[model samples]
Target: MSGDFYSERPLFGGAISSTFPLRFQDVSDIRQVPDHQEVFVDPARDESLIFELLDLKHDVGDNGSATWFLQDLATEQDAEGCTAISKGRQGREAQNLLTVYLANLRLKAVGTDVLIVAHEPILINPLSESATAVGAGLAVPAAQSGCMAMGEVFKLAVSSFKVNDWSLFGA
Candidate 1:
């Protein structure tokens, strides 16, 4: 359909970074760096954030992609206590909190690529794991079709089974 064709174009293509908020900065004391320190000061990046990996959006635009907004759900103190507080009074509190954060990210990403990255374990508990297993946009494609669709037809095209009518759009 038109939706799939629009999603497969490359007029708005780009990749999303892993984490948005927790980026690396200059470390005054190099020795203070932990062995598992995820933050690394990259001179090339300057103030930009770094991520483990990114999801490639092939057809949105010329090399368009979306980086995920990652946050560390780990804590130095008692995780059980925090989890209890998150689920004790209100069962939906924790999910709601995360959803609000993601919604804010989505809003901030109105003009650019936005992705939310969180570990499976941290995002869901054992008993309630299946709830978030499918994820927010699992059934939907990762392409950003909003801006691309608004452009002229020259910027969007779709692949087809036959070559007789190259103007056709699909698959």
Candidate 2:
């Protein structure tokens, strides 16, 4: 994480931008998917970034709350030890915050009912306040594992993800 550098890479019609090591390929064009807004891959780092949109009308076979939507997703992956984040005295969390995924999880939620989802495999080190999925449930050097150093980069991409065009999700 020391001495490494990063630059901005915008995606999804410039609605969001993220910092990568300036080496990862921005496959946003050639690797296009029907519902995916953006995709970036860094094979050297064995890492990937995927930004997807879920149209409530088209994607959900049944009308369910965002929590149920996310729960179904977790169940598909057989994700173990799934837990919701602690709530405040009001029994609610930050606006739109629905879930904190496993191993340095994400704050998943419905972005304007469009359900913009950002998925990443990263482990968070609470003491250091960084994230990445590598070395999760194990002790190892980050540099050797290659995931520890990507904590900041992952955070940047995720925190910046936004739905610039609300219409895309329908009015």
Best by TM-score: 2
Measured by C-alpha RMSD in angstroms, how accurate is candidate 1? 18.6
Provide backbone clash counts, one per model: 18, 4
- Which digits, one per residue and each the tens of the lDDT, describe model 1 over residues 1-171? 233232221111122212222123324335353321223332212111111222233344432232122122213211343332132243443331121111112212123222322211124333332334433212221124322121122122111111232122121
The C-alpha TM-scores of every prediction are 0.16, 0.46
lDDT of 2 by residue, 76-122 (tens): 54444443221112221211112332121122333333333333333
lDDT of 1 at 139: 23
